[model samples]
Target: MDDLIVKTVTKLIIPFIQLYGIFVILHGHLSPGGGFAGGAIIGASFILLTLAFGIEYTKSILSAKVTERVEIGGVIWYIFIGLIGIAISGVFLGNRVAGFPMGTFGSVISGGMISLITIGIGLKVASTMISLFHHIIEED
Candidate 1:
């Protein structure tokens, strides 16, 4: 952790790793990876940062309170989106029937609520992972 090389490498690559994670989350509907996979990727990056920089430094960047809020927000957003479907068509997560624009085929916006749902899932998963990691580390 005190190694200059490790800190430098982590600082250099963290952004790229996080960016890739976001890409996976956003393109999940069109590709093989989805919310869970993308979230794991992002979580791993944070874990890597913790390993390189120590828990105190990591906490300064992403406090436990913020992580908790993000986790709760993700679930709430997902439920809210589901409620939208029910309100529109009496079906939870109803896409087409809910009157959401389908957009062009094979496009980012084509999946309607599916993409939104995945985004919520991704955030929830990532925040949960970070929170668990912090708790486990603090227990030591």
Candidate 2:
């Protein structure tokens, strides 16, 4: 069935796309890329999969309601993380005191709050994209 084929292809493609996205996000410090760029790539990857396969196929991975909730949750988490710095350091996302080390360049934990922001951005993009895809598919 088309369903099985699409499902198989989507599974095969998602990992590579997601890995590249995360690499871009995490490597933002020494490079031009950042959370936004990486997030966009990841979101676009999902869109590609959706287009290649089908919205119904994609929805099996995550429902519209789940996507909406995840989007909202990511935003709330991002805001909370940003505010934490202000509470203690008297500045929003003040990296010097957010607790994470500004370790050596290229290290696993090099930047402070950068990874957190990247993760938040990635999740936000992914969920928003899912919601959009769901809407588009529903219009049919």
Task: Report RMSD (Å) for each prediction in the order shown.
Answer: 0.8, 2.8
Candidate 1 lDDT (Cα, 0 to 1): 0.93
The reply for model 1, stretches above 4 Å from the true place, is none
Model 2 is weakest, by summed lDDT over 10 consecutive residues, at 1-10
- Model 2 residue runs over 4 Å out of place are 1-12
What's the residue-level lDDT of 98 in candidate 1?
A: 92
User: Which ten residues in a row are the worst by lDDT in model 1?
Assistant: 107-116
Candidate 2 residue-wise lDDT, 56-103, digit = tens: 766787667788898998899898888988887888878878665687
Candidate number achieving the greatest lDDT relative to the actual structure: 1
What's the C-alpha lDDT at position 60 in model 1?
99
TM-score of each: 0.97, 0.80
